[model samples]
Target: MKILPEISRTLSEYLLIPGLTTEDCTPDTVDLGTALVRHRIGEESGVRIATPLVSAIMQAVSSPELAVALAQVGGLAFIHQNQPVEEQAADVRAVKRHKAGFRTIEVTVGPDTPLGEVARQLSATEQGVAVVTRSGDTEGAFLGIISLDDFHLERHGAHESAGSRMRGRAGLVTAPVTASLSEANELIWEHHLDVLPVLDGDRVASLVLKRDYQAHKTYHRASVDGEKRLRVGAGINSRDFKDRVPALVEAGADVLCLDSSDGYSVYQAKTLEFVRETYGDAVSVGAGNVVDGRAFRYLADAGAAFVKVGIGGGAICTTRAQKGIGRGQASALLDVVEARDAYARETGVHVPLCCDGGLLNDSHMAMALAMGADFIMLGRYFARLDESPSPKVQIDGQWYKEYWGEGSQRAQNAARYGQGGRMVFEEGVDGFVPYAGSLYDNVERTRAKLTSTMISCGSTNLRDFHRDAVLVPVSAESFKQTGAEVQLRRPTADH
Candidate 1:
């Protein structure tokens, strides 16, 4: 048996050498935009994300809520397929229905509805804002809004009607449907209103909140479809592509990914062929979890819009432990990127490379991009956010969100593992991640760090980072030296 001479490397084992920082190179000028699908050498990709971040296709990570939030911040989320096809399609629809900056009034109450019922409805809604319509329908005659600040359960009687407590439409600030977001924001600020109901001839069309408007301003690069809906992706499996693909497409999924623990096989090839033949170039489908150049070339040739790199490197994955069949994440990405570039040179089609899993910190993300990754797919990172599908629980007075791998027994996702009708064994684990706050806050901070890293590398865009960024392998001692050595400070006791 022949063995390769070069050693497989991990991202932690290397460090980026700062390039010449130019006067124009700054965090504000750095653009993280990258292609999400294959395109001709000089032509633009049909699908592109404003930022190079993607949520993983796992139940605990990507959800309808998370998809909307990620898309709002210029990233993409692949809705997990660990549930029924109908449920998955419904989730895709939920994301597609979401219009950035404007929230659809899910909970509406009649003028005579009891305060207790209004409270219940508000509790069920994410925004905690309920509209008081004439017929209690979303499209009914506009009345007023009932926010959590409108009444207290203890102070207000349960028998009291919402109309009595709600601020009446006479004094409530409302904007016309034709008004732009800027004009609406001006009205909101002028009236000091928390919620501005955009009206269409006395009917409540949508509600725009001050917080959502601020978020829109902060993340102006939100990824959206032609109709201005948040862009979302759906995860499908090779076994059920026939039934799943059509449903997801009909449900308004912007993109599709064949989620598999191992994607280099005849099953994946057949599925890719079917998608290409049936949908042509209309459906952008990506595939992977490959660890080598051969696998990358195979998928790229099979019409994969983008190829995911890394195997057995996810935070919850145990594939390498259970079965010794994976490569180092950094090495895998490097090899696949080389193959991707070569393939582009040959066919004039540049298929983007996504580094999935094995990224522990923001530095790792920067390193991955510098090493030629078009973008990075994160499971643990997004799984901790409030937008994730999982619920948060307090442990040892510290909050943590539940996280599980698709291969875990808790998931029982056999289609992703390709182990027949049912999972023969578990290749992943169920675990917890430190609960992070809202997706917008965390993503903004992460983006700032990434931009700074790019600026340090003297690059203003992802393509420039790929070309100019230089990395050098570091020794185990040097790696340890990179961390703070004098971290002996402890929290002061509160009296």
Candidate 2:
């Protein structure tokens, strides 16, 4: 057997050499916008993201809530397919139904409902507010609103009906459906109102909360479709593409991705063919988890909108140890990127590359983009956020969120592993990640760091970063020297 001479390398083994800092190259000027699909050379991609990041297709990371949050922050999340088709489609619909500055009246109660039940419903909502509608339907006749501040369970007996405590519509300040978001916000702050229900005739159409307006102000670069709904993606396995594709499309999924541990196979090819034949160019589907240029070329030629580059490199993945069939993440990305450029030169089709998994920090993300990735896919990063579907638990007085791989025993997603109808063994581990606060805060910080790096590299956009950025190999000792040398101070008791 012949062996390659070059050694496999990881992103940590290299460091970016800073370039000239031009006067115009600043973080504000650095544009992270990137293509999410294949397009002809010199033509803009049909699907593009304002940010070059995406959440992974795992049960613990991507959910309807997470999808909406990420889309609002200018990124995208692929809803996992570990469950039934109907459930996944419903999750897609939930994301599609999301309105940026408006809150759907999910927690609603009738006027006669007990305060105890209203409390339960309000507690389940993030806003701690509930609408008191005539028939308890979200769009039922307008009545009033009840919040935690309106009454306390101890002061106002739990047995009291919501009608007894709620502020009636006649006294409440309401906005017409034609009111703009800014106008609603103005009314909310002017009247010291917690929520301004937008009424369509006598029915409560939707509620605009103070916090939602503030969130919109913070994340104004939200990714949306032509209809102004949040953009969301869904993952599909090769085995169920025939049945799953139509349902996801009908449910308003903006894009589809073929999720597999090893996507360079006949199964993925057949799935791509079926999607292309049935939906034409209307459905943008990506495929991957490849480790070489050959695999990249194969998928690109087979009509993959974008190809994911990485294998056995996820935080929870054990494919390399269990099966010994994977390459180094950095090396894998380098090879695929080379092929991608060549393919573009030959056919004039510029298929984007998604650097999936193995990224540990903002530095790694910058290195991935510098090495020629159009976007990055993150599992552990997003899994730690409040938006993730996983529940958080306290361990040793430290909060952690549950994070598991699609191939883990907890997930039992056999279709992702392509191991018959059942999983013979686990190829991933169930674990926990430190709880990071909200998606907006973390994503903003990440964007700042990445943009700062681009500025240092003298690049104002991703295309310039790809062309002008330079990286050099670093020794193990040099890598260690990059961290702090002195002993770190211990945190105070108060801190």
Candidate 3:
């Protein structure tokens, strides 16, 4: 028995816990928006967006229903992939859509177009972004990009054309006469420039103007992705019930995302009721990919915990082009806001609302939050990764991943609809998707980018992003100047 002296702190000494200095122990006061958004779904989840920021769901890559899974973690998904209308509708029925701030409206533009011309186009349409392409073909490689404000000076005849201005400049000013999105914003306000152009390589590829960008940038939000008790979700096609939903729940799915192209169908309504009755509130229900709030109301009446709002707003989605049946994201967001508020007031349940699409970047997310959404869903952004069903492979000596519709004929037939006309869903039923790898990296990187945007507005959290921000349209030159031609600085997470 080695007798070691027993050492113990006295009661009084024990009172002094390490790391407990309390000259002022009170916590700093946080606003409602920040307070509500400070929680996470599970311990492993990262910081919440405070505003719902989600990616779009296009079958060309990922399904809209898959977007709901991301939303459970405080993101949005757009379901406008190139699937058939019925199949697309079925995908929308697969997840819960919550109304919250945060959006990103993805758009595209050609590479050959002059920056000045692109700026004018954006100005005329009041569109915020333009995804620049190197070729005239849709599948063409990416080229340099631009924002509307990049062309502000050039459009205003600051030095005739951008070429002339750059040529006229002497010394260090010889570089492209454009700014990144952040710098362009500063220039737009400080110099009161209109449009900002995003440059790619040396030429202007796209543009973002003060007014148009701001139009979707401004809004207010209380909280995003901060639900406490039950997870509200829904299923799209009956076939997903056994397969996808069970797996999602086992992985921490609380809400059921019931989505569809049209929310007014009997099939959707019955599906909503069936989910509510079958799940018996074990999971809170959410439904719809409806543009206006009508579908939201229907789903709510059918025991939906949340409603998804959106018609057609997604990158890689040809819905608008294919069907020409959809509402603009801005208008749809407002409509859902009205419906959600009114419904909440009418019913004591206070079910949340979710914006389903029309988001391109951090600013769009802020705008959606300001418009009063509880959550946002994402799709295309989250795809192209390992977790996605697609398989990644080297094609044509380039990194490429397979993307397809979950409700396509191939999918529907494979699902094996029974004699009762209902599809059977079970685990392992998730269709084939290419391996993109490390969604954590993609999501985290995007989050960092969004945080930088928030910081630019002097906001520490997504809450402040909504409260303290301004949006304004711009002229063509300004748009061009704010484009990729200028270096868009990536922000550090700590920033």
Give TM per candidate. 0.84, 0.85, 0.47
- Candidate 3: tens digits of C-alpha lDDT, residues 134-252: 45333444443345544564345432332322211112111133444456566557756454444344444444455634432432221123432112222445445445444445444
Q: Provide the overall lDDT of each model, using Cα atoms, as 2-decimal numbers.
A: 0.88, 0.90, 0.47
Q: Can you write out model 1's per-residue Cα lDDT over 409-472, one digit (the tens) per residue?
A: 8898876776886989999999899998999899899999999988888999999999988999
Question: Could you tell me how far off, in angstroms, the CA of residue 463 lies in candidate 2 after the best superposition?
Answer: 1.4
Comparing 2 and 3 by TM-score, which wins? 2
Candidate 3: Cα lDDT at 12: 14
Q: Which stretches of candidate 1 lie over 4 Å from their true place?
A: 108-122, 127-178, 187-205, 391-399, 435-438, 480-487, 491-495
Q: What is the C-alpha RMSD of each candidate to the true structure, in Å?
A: 3.8, 3.5, 24.4
Superposed Cα deviation of residue 462, candidate 3 (Å): 5.0
Error of 2 at 378 (Å): 1.6
The TM-score measured for candidate 1 stands at 0.84
Candidate 2 residue pairs in clash (backbone atoms < 3 Å): none
